[model samples]
Target: MTTKVLLASADERTLERLSQVLAEADAIELVQVVREAANVEDALTRHPDVDVLVVDELIDSGRGLGVARTVGAANPLLGIVMLVDQAGPEQFAAAMESGARSVLSRTSSLAEVVSRLESVAHWVGAARSAVSADARSGRAGRVVAVAGAKGGVGASAVALLMAQSLVSSRTVGLVDFDLQSGDLAAYLGVHTRRSVVDLVDIAGEMTGRILRETSYDVPGGIRLLSAPNDGERGEEMTARAARSVVNALRYQYEVSIIDVGSHLTEATAAVLEEADVAVLVVTPDLPALRAARRTLAMWERLVVRQRSAVRVLLNRQHRRNEVTESLAAKIVESRVDATVPDGGSPFESAMNTASVAAASGPAHTAAAKFAAAVVGPVDDGPVDAVEEAYAEVAGRGRRRARGNDAGQSAVELPVAFAVALMVLLLAGQGLVWGTGYLLARNAAHEGARTVGLQAWGPSTPGAARADALDELSGRWRSAATVDVSPSDVTVHVVAPTVVPGVRLTSSVSAPVQREH
Candidate 1:
């Protein structure tokens, strides 16, 4: 039988090119091609028979990693292949981290693309066989997290859609732990009087009935543990409390999808530690990429120190940005596991209305495809060290930008001083002049021996005149003449002669322009 495949990408050229390549493959059928990430969920909703998903490395709006994770967590049996621009060890590693079964660079030959499709088709068949066996064996509960590398990467949106996809046949639970600004309950249009706080408050007394009672039902019987509307209560849900809630739901639900808010707070860290799998969400922007890099580094450190399973997701991918899946993976030193498309205005509308299913436009279809991949079959492999290193470097770079200051204080201080000088020259002339004079004097006094300059004024008139001229010439690197009769130098300081924080003492033989 021919394998049914879905394509999720933001670039028209890429989609057309890949579709043409796949069309030539006799073993694969291009069942659907979605332009937006949000449509993936709807596609899965409408066509439950898709065997594999070919997604771009980056989506237009949400993080591609998040989309991939959502797909993997929701479907767990679908074959996922991420399309990246450049092939590198780091890119490949990040792709795998995001839950992609395979990575294909856009530069691959059409024939190679066909060959990969055939291979993925075979893998899909094998996965289906394994899933059938697992079903018969009655062991299929999985806990997955949709977490942002930083805040606002759309992890919650991905979680909502993933839960929606699984609600059809299996018991799926959506837990929102953003606490302060969670939108899970609002997205599902469920008003829960009870929340994770309630669960935490009744930790010892928790029961299946209590959980069921607190959870609000969405379309297709998916249950949602809505976050407390009160920001203070949400804040009170500590990492320990979140762990308790997740552990409780793990026993009763077949699939538990979590929306971990941005920031590795104690609560989020706790969730990351306990989750069977984590989807690290990021965007194409530098800040998001940097955060994702840091998040990955933190996860690796935790893994080495504590052992955890973490993945990556790229969201809001567009064709215009400099940051592509390949570049992102290279920077973060990991392969992109999956990707989603830009969901467009339709997604925003759905988000506004508080309905995951209502977002059932084109983007939802793409989301469903991702969801299928999440619950589908997968092959576990060892973590890539190169990817980890890249993540470490990128994470370190971000930390430095955020004032990490790891053993480079001396270097940073000089650079910072230079920058301050430049800023003063451009924006604060009066303040800069006053501050620069005082600073320069102090620096000259401190490093006088190094620069061979005198620190104080001379006592005798003749000596003072010579000393002033010498000091001015030495410090300012400009000619200075002393008039013994005149008290001070009328010497002019030219442009480029003034060193930052350097004071010039001089007596001029002739009147001159003192360029301040």
Candidate 2:
């Protein structure tokens, strides 16, 4: 990004010299000159892209401090330069209090002034990049925030995977804002000495160069801004610095993903508010669902009319007779955009190797849907159909929930059909057992008759009984026994049970008679 600068000074000589010096730098473009402090506001308004404000300490008849303070307060990311005749402790303090990064001697060589300007320009560009489009103009990076309703809910995994999905199409930045217990780095099997904490610590000297240095590349194409390696350093990062770093990331990447782990922090609110799609990743569990309800409620209460961007995502889903995605969403009073299948052995292998798994099926589909919620099509290819369907249902549900007949929508056809299918399967199993038992009984009776007839026929009773038992054995292979005597024949059979280690039995017999 080319840095835009507004040079303000009462003296034409100062303006001319500064303009000439800034013009010499390829990275900076002099937007306009502010002749007076009163004109500073108008100049910035006229050139909204101006990132740095260069003003003489004596500008506006010695009101430079007031102007710098006022402008700095409005645009915290803007870099301010104080031109001093002689630098001193008092002067430096005043300059900084007024939001200047550093003070440079007025009589400093053109080289020094140019160098200072370059530094300011870099920070200005970074600051400009940091803000979302909703916060500022010229940048349109889509921000997606993945936060857990509770710890260990896979928010970091969701965030990393979502970012990875977008990498094929756009530059992505994945930030670990979990702070205290950030395990995002561990998930990817990569570690970095520098982190977002480091960026925030040097906020005063923050520039594009500094911000880029703190980011580390992971196995996936996405760049990672991890939490501090030393857990104690989390508290050291302040909200203001985090804000700056976020804005810089917004400008630098096409999509920015933030993993704000379970607990709500001072900085988490800002990221959530700025995100285009703020996803609350939770499992279909009581604790996580409860936390999700609390978090979403709090967002509504705090942000006021800004909850539209919020989405609830269920992760690490497993097939259970009792758990359903719709139920979880209903309990949380939100829509479930997607249910990510459990990572399973693939994820476990990745964990062991410190790398990402090429997880297909549900995991891949969920990540693709997640990416589509906040970003455009991948590589100009179609967005995931599942995401499109999720989006459609969510829109309809919201509209239906708002209308007078909201309760009518509760009978969701899909959920109803799922329940119906389960019922059908259970009923079908009963029929299977009934038919098997009936057939077994008939076969046993037929066997008994054959032996009973033979006992009165030309063949010997033992041969007839053996033949009957063999026929019964083939027809009803489950289990069977036969007994024959001069006057009667009896047969017993056992059928397989629906469940393991259980069986169903049937019995039949016939009386012996003269050959008929």
* Cα TM-score of candidate 1: 0.45
Off by over 4 Å in 1: 1-140, 303-308, 377-516
Q: What's model 2's overall lDDT?
A: 0.68
lDDT tens digits by residue: candidate 2, 374-417: 57654343332223333444566556545544355556755755
* Highest-scoring model, lDDT: 2
Q: Which ten residues in a row have the lowest lDDT in candidate 2?
A: 129-138
Candidate 1's residue-wise lDDT over 298-370, tens digit each? Answer: 7677662121345566777777777888998877666677666678787887788876565476556656777
Q: After the best TM-score superposition of candidate 2, give how far the Cα of residue 292 lies from its true spot, in angstroms.
A: 0.7
Query: Quick one: best TM-score, which candidate?
Result: 2
